[model samples]
Target: MKAPAISLLAGLLFGAGLAVSGMADPARVRAFLDLFGAWDPMLAFVMAGALMPMTIAWLVQQRMPRPIACEAFDLPGTGLLDAKLLLGAILFGIGWGIGGLCPGPALADLAIAPSEAGIFVVAMLAGMTAHRITRG
Candidate 1:
């Protein structure tokens, strides 16, 4: 119960940050990726801002036995590079580049622009399903 509530609160804060940072806007993200064209550096700033807190959290996690809301940290164990990881990363990059809407931003955009965001979210879900089916 506590873990779920904490997760929900964290998600809400993340979504709010995305919205406030203009990261939920596909055009803004697209512009950031357009290095040779009308490039925008706002995303870099947002990334830096996000990185700071995450870095601190990771450092804190190292000193703590477990999270306050959970028995374990639930962090990923693997740091190994593999074909599957590479392929998934490539696919994710392709999708992000083409649509300018990654999962977080796309999910956040759903409330502001349902039609566009819905299409992206549905496609993303389909990709996730395909990956799961193929993995097994």
Candidate 2:
């Protein structure tokens, strides 16, 4: 199939899987993340289920023939857990904890309330654009 068709199919599958797995539910995620409160571990199990296939695929990729470009995998060069990385992670965690909705969940929430999700998504895209511009 063509690249656009393949990409669209992959996105559809991913969205459907997220919907089926309840990852789109902020309340469910909030409950799962509330370890100190009435802690629910179901999301961990769900994440494990989701990751297993991806993990297997990644392992398989390690043994595959290199692409025609004739270069080794261009993985991230920096392995250091630097201060910037740590700070970014902390900010992300805080946002998730406060909102009970990460990007995917927020996007999925669009199905129920388009205006809110549309605003959030637009703001997110704007932030990304600004970051790229500033960094570049």
Using TM-score, give the best candidate's number.
1
Q: What is the lDDT, from 0 to 100, of the residue 37 in candidate 1?
A: 100
Span of 10 residues, lowest total lDDT, candidate 1: 70-79
Query: RMSD of model 1, in Å?
Result: 1.2
User: What overall lDDT, based on C-alpha atoms, would model 1 receive against the true structure?
Assistant: 0.92
Give the TM-scores of the predictions, in the order they appear. 0.94, 0.79
Residues 19-70, candidate 2, lDDT per residue (tens digit)?
7777776677788889899877878888899788999977987887763243
Per-prediction CA RMSD (Å): 1.2, 3.1
The per-residue C-alpha lDDT of model 2 at residue 119 equals: 74
Give the per-residue lDDT digits (tens) of candidate 1, residues 10-68: 99998999999999999999999999999999999999888888999889989998789
After best superposition, candidate 2 residue 18: deviation in angstroms? Answer: 1.3
